[model samples]
Target: MLFVGGITLLKNFERLMEAFARVHERQAIPLVVVGFNRWRFENDLAFAKSHRASAHILFPSFVADEAMPQVYRMASCLFFPSIYEGFGIPVPEAFATGCPVVTTNRGCTSEVAGGAAHLVDPFDVEDMAQGLELVLSDQAYCQELIARGRARPPTSASTAAPVNPWIYSSKYFTKLPNRRGPRASLAAPWGISREPLRQCQTYQGTNYMLPPGGVMVDSPDRGRYI
Candidate 1:
């Protein structure tokens, strides 16, 4: 079974369904389009009926999130050919569940997949056909992707959050100053290379780096120190 989502203009709904229709003509696959918005649903239904391709088009808009796992499990792969995205979270979520993903190469989708998913041009029907064929025809390749996805590390949020100042200092500031200041020996308590100072120079009570002279003194705080 194949899962489809949404019918918005920017969602590439028409291109996706058209690709599926072409693929199905060659080999029939059960497709269920999960939809929202009653008017768009009705319009899609009419389009499907008029095209005489209603057999494979099933609309199940009421499925709950908890049951989405069963839908993912039932399918061999998830097909998404969106033209653009800010960050494609669902691609990784599907990967976490052991479902192989076939999505477009644009936007953050490619970056998120990290070679775990097959990428194709969303605007090219032929490329989409080839991608679907590759996955559905080759069981070994599909399993390789699934296993690779399983080995992928979980996302970390600290990447975006403000981290402790000490961590940044310890990791990067460990390097010695290129040129020492006049009183580098005394005022710079992190002495030449001796006992580490709990705190470095401060500009107006704020932590700052020592000047080129590497001198630490009671001089008035300057804005450049920061």
Candidate 2:
């Protein structure tokens, strides 16, 4: 199964949905999407339903924190082709869980993916579809990506450099609290320490401490998420 976690317009749900539609057109792989609800849910669903691929997409919006690691373990790969990202937590979360990642090259996602992900164009459905195909069709390549992800632990030195610019410029994190020592280990239920999620910051100014990150909401006007 393929997984795409989080919510946002920048996350390119429509593009992902359409790309999955194309993937389904060629093969019958199911997509498991986990996140909060979106305003375009009905429209995205309608589009996928029209393509007759709705049944192949699963949306379990609220997976308890206790059960999230199991969700990642079940996934064949994690697809997060966002047009913009402050720093994608899910990419590393999947990486930590030994799941191959497929994300966009744009924005902070590239920085956090740390050359361990299958970078794709979030704007191009065909490109995203091709990424999906490559991951699902090439077991050796997929395993290689997973192995690389494992080698580069979330907060390890391997992932510290090449930080995304948004890591400091994000409007959501404008009021970030100061930190002295290394951040506390923020692990999910299954010993998966979520480090990249530290970069997420919502505009509403909600506190996003600890693992698993915060609930993301996209602003239609700015096309940014928090």
lDDT of each: 0.61, 0.67
For residues 121-174, write the lDDT of model 1, one tens digit per residue: 988988887888788778999998888776665342111112222112233233
lDDT of 2 by residue, 145-165 (tens): 999988764543222222323
RMSD of 1: 14.3
Poorest 10 consecutive residues by lDDT, candidate 2: 160-169
Name the runs in model 1 displaced over 4 angstroms: 38-42, 156-226
RMSD of each: 14.3, 11.3
